[model samples]
Target: MQLVTWNTQWCCGLDGVVSPQRIVQHARALADFDVLCLQEIAVHYPALEGNAGHDQVALLRALLPGYQVFFGAAVDEWTPDGQRQRFGNLIATRLPVLQLQHHPLPYPADAGVRSMPRMCTVATVRDPGLGAVRVMTTHLEFYSKRQRMAQARALRVLHAQACAHAVAPPEASGDGSPFQSKAHTPHAVLCGDFNFEPHEPEHAAICAPAGADDSEGAPLGMRLWDSWRLLHAAAPQPPTFRLYDRRYGPEPGSCDFVFVSDSLKGRVQRFVVDAATQASDHQPVAVSIA
Candidate 1:
């Protein structure tokens, strides 16, 4: 299975043009992805840089036929025209979606710092090579360090929760009830714009083992292995943001990543970053798993 993750910046390219079609085209040029995870997708929010309030979810769904689109809006509000405006993460999968969930990450209020609510979109899909697997994409708080750390902790908690549920799923009805059993696998691929540099403490926090108290007796929490490190070892990670656009700062670094559960470590075949695409301020990272 091939998976790609990118922060679209609402589809605004380096030329200051916001085109969902171009974003799709650029990602397709990178790889024939079985799953695509996009962050910073806006809906009916024309105020964003170069955005014209287009429903990016619908546009992406239309562009990628036969894919199931799942959106998790971290910032949801009603515009002056009574239309809904949402901004958050998106997951598009060609695989069969067995279950879908939206998890709102920790967003402790910090009046001094400007930050928005963050969320992770989780989907359990049936992959031809890996069978049932959990996939999640998220965008963490950018301006608030405290919030970002909290959000990272929340992600670890979520992973442990999923594993617990997978081990002891709820009882199902014998009759053809609406509440049928769905596939839930401990193996997962967590990818997205983490909003923190690869060397930051938040990155290490994410990879740290969960405490025994946090796991609820389901063994030690599953460790998430960085796909890049597993494949490249001592090599320095390529820049994924601020490569050309320096709106936030001049220094370029990698803030986007793809992490697979320890169970799926050996299955990680390849990891590549499309550094040439200017379709968005951030580059796309693709991973091939067997």
Candidate 2:
């Protein structure tokens, strides 16, 4: 399974911020991903942006056929110029999307920024080639620790749901929910800008540290594992963010990543955070898992 995660900056790069064609061109060149998760996709609904009021999500779906696309709007607002726009993350999958769900994180009062809601989107896929997998995309609050903690709890709750749903009976359950009974914990691939490092508490709640050596030199920790660290191993320069913007991290940078569950870590044969890419402010992370 090939998966990708990128913050398109609403496809605002190179020439202009609202160039839809640039978004298509650059993202297509990024990778041929089976499952793609994008953040900051500027989709202006009710009133369109650019020429024909082209919906960014529609354009991407048109570009990549056969694959399924799902959008979760985090913030909806009206522009001063009198157009209403929605900015949020996107989840597109080639595998059969059996179920789709979204959750909005709660923001605190002291945070001061209650303008937009942080959202998480998940897609449970039934693939003919690779069995079944769940892919999720989300953007956490960048400024508030309180909001982020709340966001983390929201994600954990959603993660637990995905795990439980993966094994649900294919036939409708007693409550009318449909899921397969024999399914397992569901191979999940979480992609996005977590805004926290591997050792950070936020990271711990998401993809728990895995594949690292313990005191007994054994590979053990929690449930989820960092796919980036697993793929790169001990490469000296693994900076993803500093590849374009030089002033983001302290000693160079590397913030973007693709994290997977421990059960699927070995399935990942390739993982690359595109540092040299000029399409967006942050580099894109691509991972191939079997």
Candidate 3:
């Protein structure tokens, strides 16, 4: 399966134009993705640069027909016009979605640092070859180091929780209720704009194992492995941000990445960063697993 993750910056390109259609076009040009994960999608928030309070989730849904779209709003509020405005991550997939979940990451208050609530959207999809696979996408806190670390820890906890569920699934009623059994695989792909460079401790924290106790004889749950490292062990990671847009600072480096559980490490066929697209301030990262 082919999956792509990108932070659209609300679809505003380097030219300062916010167009959802343009974002879709750029993504399609990258690859024929089975799943597309996006972060920083805004809805009814005109304060963003080049954004006019457009419903990005709706626009993307309309653009990609037959794709199941799931939006996890970390910042949800009502607009002056009484419309519900949301800002967060979105996952759209052409594969069959069996289950969906929105997990709000830890957001501890930090004084004098601009930060916002963040979330990860998890979807269990039926891949034609992989069968059941859990895919999750998230955008970590950018300004506050403490908050980002907490959020990273929370992601590890969530992964462990999902594994526990998979190992001991709940009993299902056979009374023909709508609550039927569904596929829940321990194998997961966590991808998104991590907001931390490879040199940062937060990156290592996320990839760290839950604990020795948690993996006592389980062949299912395992620590996440960096997809880039799995494929390019000797090469430096390609820059995924600050390549051309240096408004924040100079020096190009990667903050976006695709990480897979150890179980799926060998299945990782390709990992790439689309450095050519200026569709957003951040570049798109694609991963192919077979």
Candidate 4:
């Protein structure tokens, strides 16, 4: 199934289509995606230059008729008194959603240090061909490295639990299959702005198998694997962040990523970083796996 993960920057761009409309346009552009994971999807925040923003979930549901919508709101508050300012990650899928979990990531050691709170939303998508699989999306902490590391660790834990639950026991299926031996695990696609460069030391732990010890030498329970490396089997040399647009040249790569379990590496058909697009400060990323 085709899948896309993009950070639209609340759809504030030169197109003037507005956040809701941009979500629609972008979804339409990606035509046949089985799953679409989005970050920075604002509901009440207006564009940087256009009309007042509309409900992103409602608008996108219209754009993607066959897909079911799931949103994880990171913030729900008003600028002053009554206005609502809600924004967070979103998951749209054509696959049947068996269940979903939205939880806050781990915070840094120094709680008082101050940083933006982040969240990771996990969704169980049912594939008739492959049964059920986990699809997750999250925007990592931007300012604090400690927080990001902790968040990454927490994400792994959550992913392992969700994945464990997704598998249907042979007896539960009523097929009367005697033994329930799991020889191979299914796939889990984790996408979003990790806020860390590719191959960064902090991510070494996240990229490791579930329950492996981290860089700190402490035991980590849930091992979250990297789908990119699973598919590529290697990290691309140099950085993958900022891009020189129509105005500038090659800048630096910032935050963006797609990770999956090691077993499904060969399934990745292609991985593209569309940083040249003017849709937002960050470019869109698409990964097609069989």
Report the C-alpha lDDT of model 1 over 116-188, residue by residue, as the tens digit. Answer: 8999999999998788899999999889999999998788778777777677787865566767776757889
Displacement of the residue 274 alpha carbon in candidate 2, Å? 1.6
The better candidate by lDDT, 2 or 3, is 3
TM-score of every model? 0.95, 0.78, 0.94, 0.79
Whole-model alpha-carbon lDDT for candidate 3: 0.87
Q: Give the least accurate 10-residue stretch of model 2, judged by summed lDDT.
A: 210-219
Cα deviation of 208 in candidate 4 (Å)?
1.8
Model 1 clash pairs are none
lDDT of each: 0.88, 0.67, 0.87, 0.69
Across 48-92, the per-residue lDDT of candidate 4 in tens digits comes to: 355546777678778777889999987777876587877889999
Q: What residue runs in model 3 are displaced by over 4 Å at the alpha carbon?
A: 175-180, 212-221
Worst 10-residue lDDT window, candidate 3: 212-221
Which 10-residue window of candidate 4 scores lowest in summed lDDT?
A: 213-222
**TM accuracy, model 3:** 0.94
Segments of candidate 2 deviating more than 4 angstroms: 14-17, 45-54, 78-83, 113-115, 165-185, 209-222, 234-237, 246-252
